[model samples]
Target: MAEYSLLIVEDESTLRRLLEYRLGKEYNVRTAENGVEALALLDEEIPDLIISDVMMPKMDGFALQTAVQEREDTKAIPFIFLTAKADEESRKKGQMTGVDDYITKPFDIDRLISRVNRLLERTKIFQTQLDAKIGQDFSQKLTPKTMPVVSGYTTHFYNVPKGHGGGDIFDWTETRPGTYFITIGDVMGKGLQAKFYAFSFFGYIRSTIHTMLGATDSPAALVAGVNQALVNDSTMEETFASLLLLRWEPEHNTITYANAGHCRPILVSERGAEIVTYSDIVLGLTPNSEFKDTSISMKPGSALVVYTDGVSEQVGKSDEMLGEEGIIKVVQNAYGHAEPIDAMVQGILDESKHPEFDDDVLIFWLERLTSMDRQTPRWFSPFRDVAEGS
Candidate 1:
């Protein structure tokens, strides 16, 4: 049986000891003399929930709540204020400060314990659901359960929900060793209808990529075929997408990319980060426009990060963009040596000064192939003719 820990902060010795004694029967309880002491304890280890007196010297409950709310780690911790003040103003202030609940000083022990347990349970459930939703969306890939053996080149995928699910799809497939194809498309509109449109567009793009695997169609012609397909058939009348098609060839250490009204792909290399942009209009809107493809030689230890407009155009806490520069800085600081890929992703989110995302963010990291993996495929038969003759 695991014990749920509870932290109690009260300036009065009698109340602190009494509450700790009663609650300690079921929970592992720790008491603090005041907010300052409680904060110090928090530094040592986080408690499942916090129950604190409203008034105290060297940091009142209000001040403590404000402080905790300012930090991301502490903000979500359930807060309950134990106060003697029954006045409307004090209660209003506590409510405004976003304390989960308030109990008058002469409180009922059973009720307090019950509320605390409930809060913790609800928090766990919400987080569980969030995890489930993310898992369900990215159904195909496991999230880096094993650390990437090679450093630098890795791809990260995310599912960002737009209103009612519009036309946004991003995918990556390894066609051959050291060769990968990345596809991103934004369908026009929001909700289930838009999601339907996006799904169709994605299928078309995926099929086209597969069909053209050994064929020589430039990115523009690929887009033209997709656009013409959508326009030619009335079933996809509502679908229009800003598409980007990119291929990374490990053999030549090069990246061939083309964009159709999509955001530029930023490369984080040994030389630092730089954006690679080329001209191509949005797909599906026009049927016969020519598009050009561009290519770049990849450095051995570089990462090509691509995203939908969501990330590049996101508005941060200060109302400024979590721009390309911000993303680059975050990636560079977190992506040291060969840590686990999930660590790198979480690190970026942790470094994000603000928590809000104005738009969906998708980050893909393409690391260069290490020497070990760049070897020739062992299963290919070079002596098939000789064996047949014999």
Candidate 2:
């Protein structure tokens, strides 16, 4: 019994009043005298559906529909036309103008209500399917954003899209008891197109992990397998991906990981922080690339900040980029913070100075916050505070 908002845009007061009276009981309805009034109402608050008269002063129904279609924000809203003529030409024109439903003059109240319900239900179903497609099962999709909870770790992910799409992929899923596979990758260049490359990469990771259930589930092997698959993919010949793959074993309290031409992740713990790096070429660009594995003990009260170049290479006002050292400073400055991950990112952004980011930024982590029992050496306490007291 959710109350959906409906907008009625008719110049005639009688019909408008009738619709308000009829639909008001079941829906949160608003009335507009003409297309201009409808546009004004749209500016104030977007209704779920728009019901507009075909003929009105200032702006006609066609003009209003065209304007709505032009504006990015309002273009997708479901629209209906209320016309006096029930001719075939008018119906065809309404369809051409992308009208979702139509109601002719002398229409029955029941017919109008039924059409309204059908359109709203159809739109709801479409939206549900779209959401599901964006984040379907067996995957942690990162289109809009993704934050997942896995036992034994505190996790957070932040993604700032550069445009319609820039190539940044992040996925993490538990494989078996106390084991997980996480990946963060950036496809070369920006502006999302095929997206097939990124999509294929995720598929390969999951399949490779499952295939290696009893054999190998290490980061190096998984990344190497992905590289081979990408090399075999003809569609990705013109592009390459820089990826960091990680495998966490909670039982062993260890992380075995590898990099494919990606920035090293910061391992922050009681010993302060150290960069975990490995030598490997960018995936797909080179043939027969071998990525070596590096394993690190998951210290009690430790966190790992895994990210792409967008974060580590954030440009500042001085034209100096906040590189690896700068990120480390941000982390140090964010120490003892209630939300250390967010504080650390804000510190980095503050250092960058610009109100907008030039590239999509992602700051991700797998963490266990600090405890008094595990304290770093007093000498290692202060290295750099990128944005302290800001």
Candidate 3:
């Protein structure tokens, strides 16, 4: 688990030091003399919990809390007020401001610590629940597990769980005889909301793909339709998605794919493995978007890997990131090995295990160039975000 950082914002230097010393026993604590100093600290790094005095020189605790609530990044951090005034108006004002907890002057050390710890724990629990919801929403609406006829080349997926549910999703459907439409997407955000956005984007892609099958049967048109649909949806205005829509035309022995705000697909051939980075705004975040399609002819032994940021973001135990270069190195090392794509993914994941995940991870491997009349991707329901778009 990541260490919780507590920020103390009291004007008195002596009280700040005493509180920092006391809280440092349990949490990583930082002290600031006033709201101005506290804001400066916040600009540097966000603390998990903030303990501020109600009265101060430049920025008071009330003003700080209000500012925090107004900002998107800081609004979620828990806030607690420390006030010498114990009047009804003060208490009511603090409560109305959504103060997680309050401490009166001459507070018992043990009592203050206990309250802070409880609030911190509660904040953690809320974050966990939110993340779980995102995963559930994605799985419910658009998981590949739910599909009947799998699309594209056949490859087993490795189990690489993100501590929180992530925004990565991949699905497929057949457009014609010996031709399959595959879609992969990553939604912006963390936890369930990310998953929710993924599902919404997946649904739009599925419906649009189906419609395209009856219309032009062009990969570019299909991508354009999907992008327009997502752009038109008001619910997804704040949320954006990166997508790669692949169409396998076996008759031509070629695969054509269009990208929208998604990472480029990689082709692992006998010669070498290279990333293909052709992408155009993650859908919904922009309008009147123009997307481009790329074509690649596959050899018999060739394979395609579509992955989320998680695969590239594998963190080591020492807080070191296993970046894209590391991922490419791992992939290069696995090449020509007897291991299947599943094993390759698992090996990468095994090499990248940490105590916790910074974000959700997903790896989708597509094998073979020929047709496999297998099941496609399935649907998962969206978690209703009560906070917004409710």
Error of 2 at 352 (Å): 1.6
Q: Tell me model 3's lDDT, rounded to 2 decimals.
A: 0.74
**lDDT of each prediction vs. the true structure?**
0.71, 0.77, 0.74
Top TM-score hit: 3
Candidate that beats the other on TM-score, 1 or 2, i.e. the better one? 2
For residues 345-371, write the lDDT of model 2, one tens digit per residue: 778768776866677677677776444
> Which model is ahead, 1 or 3, in terms of TM-score?
3
Q: What lDDT tens digits, residue by residue, belong to model 1 across residues 1-390?
A: 447788999999988898899989988999898888988998888887899898999999998889889888888889999999988898999999999999986878889888988998897677657655543353222112332232335545555564433456777677776666767767766544565567667778878877876775466666767777887888887677788887766667777878888877777665677778676888767767668889988776677766666666665556576676776666666554464235545654554556544444455566775554455555454576567668
Off by over 4 Å in 2: 1-140, 143-152, 194-196, 369-390
Per-candidate clash tally:
5, 0, 14
Give the winner by lDDT.
2
**Candidate 2: how large is its RMSD?**
15.2
Better candidate number, 1 or 2, judged by lDDT: 2
- Candidate ranking under TM-score, highest first, comes to 3, 2, 1
Ranking by lDDT: 2, 3, 1
* Model 2 poorest ten-residue lDDT run: 135-144
